[model samples]
Target: MKKKAMASFLIGYTLLFTGSVYWHGQQFSQPIASDAGQLLPTAVKSIEQAEGEKQLQEMVRRANRTGDKLSIAGMQHSQGGHTYYPGGTIIDMKKYNKILQFDPKRQTITVQAGATWDDIQRRINPYGLSVKVMQSQNIFTIGGALSVNVHGRDIHYGSLIDTVESFRLLTAAGEIINVSREENKELFPLVIGGYGLFGIILDVTFSLAKDELYETHTRVIDYSQYSSYFQNAVNSSQVKMHLARISVAPDTFLREMYVTDWTNAKDEHKLTAYNQLKEDRIIAAPKLLLGLSRYSDWGKDKFWELQRTYMKKGNGKLETRNNVMRSETAFMEYESSSRTEVLQEYFVPVSEFADYIDDLRNVLENEKDFNLLNITVRYVGKDEQAVLSYAKVDMFALVLLINQGRSSKDMKQTEEVIRKMIDITLQHNGSYYLPYYSYPTKDQFDTAYPHSKEFFRMKRKYDPDERFMNFFYREYGQ
Candidate 1:
């Protein structure tokens, strides 16, 4: 929560919006402000809102009165907190979380922007319908998911945007627009992956399907023989959910494949409330169980504590559909190094999934300088959020997670690999998702995202004064 470090980042905005008397070293109609010189930590103030349009107006008025750069985020799970733009106000939608309507016949529910995936599940569970994708850990707010275009359970459902039926978005110019496929069709897909560039998402009403159990299955497949195997899994009818999780080693790449099938959700064997005090769900199943541990905004320590508790109940070996469990936390750890810690992840086009994995395996096997941990490949449905939607390639996505320390020399090594990865991705018209931004150069992003120019054009229309922007976007570089 330290606000002292960003005195320099603040200068960029101070200089960018310096034309008018109303500016005063701050943005016009922005709710985030600070003392001249030092950047302040943007904290989430609930503003004690009621459930209606009045609350929305009051919130917008506050942003204008404050006159600092302001942006609205739902769960705030986005890494680096929207680093593309500098100091801006963040309107956290977590407080406005409530289910506005549920149309059972239509198999859809409308919830407040701040409602988490888990929140929606509980609200509609009694009706026997469930969200299709269930993106990531189920803790992400609806608005945040759309902002980032979250995807989950590979080979099953597409990105969360695929399930979105409609949404109410507040444009930068302070206009509320209700968008959907058959309704406001053009604006529909554009806003889902729109990355909050065009507007602030207020509420989302998406479609859902009847709840079904998943018969869990898992196997250890060698990395050398992954491409064809993965292609088959994606197209397979029996394999509803397929995931590629890689473990890095010197000689061999250990890839774990998780495949699941549909079962009866109403079956009594499904998860029931357990007597355990620390954890909520437990699986009473066979050995060789495959459980899921996804990421959540809650503190990493608190999340892992829950995971450990869940693990203690049953072995990680064999698990059944009714017995499978899920925890909200990614298992990425920093390797012990002498200097600083830095992270870099690059996405490769699905068409070249084979080559990307081959090149990475060659490096990790031959080179000792790189200490690799996670190498995940998943699927994404394309959208227009960022100019470079990794979803453009309707195939496999290979991620190389690198941990380079914060030293000058280590950075050089990291940059070299990153540049190469970006080159490989762009060679086949692929783009990286929002994990590590610096890896892809501005030129690379423009190439991957041909329509990105339109995103900037729309930004000017809404945030005409360039008030809602990030460091990456402000520089006109990727």
Candidate 2:
């Protein structure tokens, strides 16, 4: 039981994780300080007991009466980085995990908030069903995924919220309320990506595609042809399941086109899945050398080898989707950037895609010391399920894996690059995805999520005592 309890640390590291990680009755070790993919801090970790309605209600009353912060729980993968702790109590929901029910006829399942994608995967693998959308990684909890309304390689699968049929929210008033598409449709729209601000999501019901799904196809294109190539791929009739474009163009070649395709879930492209599942292997090279590829045309074969060797360690012809998302062995082993303090995941409306791309390229070229890696452009459809939802349109999400680990001057340059990215996205009437690491000015957030007022209103109606604010709340929350 003690060893089982230590799994809660997967949430990543923070400078001051609260002192609460004991389960069934054993504490976890203090996490080593490094920038590598982090583990949950030893502090504030606790086992997730099955607190009945009465117990939950009593806890709420005590919190409300004393104005003590409630322990907020869910998957803690905020790209905004280390923004949720210290004074804000944590509710580690790892053990609250359970597969409540599966409606095979409806392709939907109701599960506890703490269930990870992996947990869901193991259960559904035999039945051949899977969530419609998942992040680049699958280690996050279901509640966290729904709260953020995550998206992925598929343009048509919709964000995670689109698949949610219902969610049971435990209000700050200790009221256990059941909400769904048919009931409390009002709350459904707001709470999906509303973050845990509305209530503690006890369980969620969402649609899943049967394993009979298939994704077949792959095309590597240049960015110069992005306008023509991307729209064509999205509009393609040949591809069925997955459709995305990755830039394999020369780093100096701004015109990297999409490397994308379609696959079937049930059919299991064993060939394709095999490679994706393989773990990444990196040969730790100096950080500076890594930056040179973006500015110069390191030969495609050379860069490809460099990436494959450094990331995959060797050949990975026999990998799986789960492997692709789970393994972080590709990241540098050296201490993660001390300066790695900010992240910005923004979404622009479909109509603004072209302008946004042009603007992004201009910023990268013109901004001094502006280092950007892993620029991922994904598409998302409308989700009425979440008012603060960033997927209001077919979103062309330009994920900026920017490098900010440098001196103050370099950091300032990084900020300007982010500022440019945000300003342009906002000007185009786009919204910001709040889950990732970011340091957007309050004004930017306000403009990006003006409907945040509705989220605030929902929180007041339910979590009035302000028990669940995260690092994000430090500046803009109650």
Which runs of model 1 end up more than 4 angstroms from their true locations?
A: 1-53, 61-67, 83-85, 154-156, 182-184, 251-351, 364-369, 381-388, 399-413, 475-478
lDDT of each: 0.52, 0.58
lDDT of 1 at 255: 37
Among these predictions, the greatest lDDT belongs to 2
Structural similarity to truth (TM-score) of each candidate: 0.71, 0.76
Error of 1 at 415 (Å): 3.8
Which candidate leads the pack in TM-score?
Answer: 2
Report backbone clashes per prediction: 24, 54
All candidates: CA RMSD in angstroms?
Answer: 10.1, 8.0
